[model samples]
Target: MPQRLELAPPAFNRRKILIHTAAAGALAAGVGVPRWARAQSGPMRIVVGYPPGGGTDRAARLVADRLQQLLKRTVIVENRVGAGGRLAAQQLVNTPPDQTVLLLANPAVMSVSPLIYKDLKYDVQKDYVPVAAVTDYDFGVAVGSALPVKEVQHMLAWIRANPTKANAGVPGTGSLPHFFSLMLSYMAQVNIEVVGYRGSAPLITDLIGGQIPLAFDTLDSLLPQHEGGKLRILATSGLKRSPFSPTVPTFKEQGLPLSAVGWNTFFAPSTTPRATVELLSKAVFQIMSEPETRAKFTAAKMVPVAMTQAQTEASFKAFNTQWTPVIRRSGFKPES
Candidate 1:
């Protein structure tokens, strides 16, 4: 079991008062403050692994805004983009456990990358503590105007018929979309090739320009075009239809027997105090439960679901168990 930090009500109240008093005095004196002291006085940071404007970054900013209001402390989002989010994960591992630094991480940084990368810098299970799961999203299998098929069945048939044009677009190599597409090919018994792009925006741009026939990306990334009639989403990688797009069917509904749900979760250094983890987790749960917050996430085609700390850890482990073998069997190796 994870360690739990408990404090007496009276002692906690007294400590809070003392800390605030000391912080005020320190500011008045204008003396140089230590990092640990500044942690208690400075604005907290929520690190994002992707560039601004992406779903992950947007989600982090949303939570940061709310968390600042709830905690009565300034919270900022810092983007440490690169290495498919591994850079941010590594930074979090090296960060001090002062309750001021947190990370909004994707499953790839926590579960998939460790299994695939030969020299992963950190062990997620050891270096980080799961605070709360913010939101969940499913990938959508979409087609450009260049493709004749309008649905998953038709798309599969088309792929089988035109083996030479069986290329599928993904955000990047070794990404969840890549693995999910490979799983689809394995189960559907087709020879669909994957064409990886640096990110989803370029892939979607090419798809719209008829440069790519098929692409798989977060529902949020493709929903606008799908709704605008510029693209057709055949199926989503969810157990059920997405709330944002109820008319769209899931892969399971289309007889694909696959469900790949990705989530953005909050994490702190593993050495963080248990009390701090519990406090932040409670705040996150409250933030996610807000009707306005839920609406915003749904607008972005993400489902707002908050899990307890224990539940979050279990979910992480379950995802690792489910995907590690599938990724290994796919026999994909990243370029060194």
Candidate 2:
């Protein structure tokens, strides 16, 4: 055959080919950019009010890691610590509802602070919508050697007999542990003078050295000392015994009919689109349900909970209702 003449192939339009492929992808992936991917165009952040290494911060970091993988976006944990978490809460209030920032807050910031702080800058209900509940933890009723009380009943009797010496220390003034200790006093019909410490370390030091006769703090904070036999945890403020301290009795189990369960929940600015909130909420639920997450929470003495938006809100509301009367009855004055 004389030279076989073959028509030259049409020149490839790289841009046009890319455009077609992308359009085909869009159609295959369902009409437009996925809602999640669109919302995640920018980096996401989880804001924690407490310093790093604390329970809330740790939980936020864990979630950030998993969310970065699931959403294929950068995620970071920001510690906006000040004013016992109020500063962070206020920051969230002013933050745009772009779904880039979310607050990992405890009951102190979410439910108690608003009730106790007269000059609170943000109304939680109006400023933020609960996205997910990450963990549930309870307070520990610990007694020092100076008090010499082994049980809640014995502690109550001691408080009654030594009313002038009945001082209970808490990690912070307006913290749930403070109010929880007061609730114990109110229920037992004994007077207890509540004192606030800077954080758990000093509170724990005082508890061990008899600087304070009794103290209440998170079960996680008190467990080490209690387990070391430096102090004793008379009771825990949960409906059931803590998994970490199965030997310890609950306040209700000890006939107090009182419980103080605290949770670390995530909240986004109220103006965030419902679709964004739902997407983030689903991701959180998935992360919390993972066995690795549960193991980490358990190791930290916190019960892992993966509550949806409505359930988280309801839990927060019920917590407010449960503690409002006790806080009011304790006569805790608001800080300016």
Q: Estimate, for each residue in 149-228, the C-alpha lDDT of model 2 and write its tens digit.
A: 77888888788788889899999887788887776666667777888998899999988998899998989899998999
Name the lDDT of candidate 2. 0.77
lDDT by residue (187-265, candidate 1, tens digit) is 6777878999998889999998999999988888888988999889999886667778889999878876767678889
> By TM-score, who's the top model here?
2
How well does each candidate superpose onto the true structure, as a TM-score? Answer: 0.82, 0.85
- TM for candidate 1 is 0.82
Model 2: lDDT of residue 267 = 93
* lDDT of each candidate versus the true structure: 0.77, 0.77
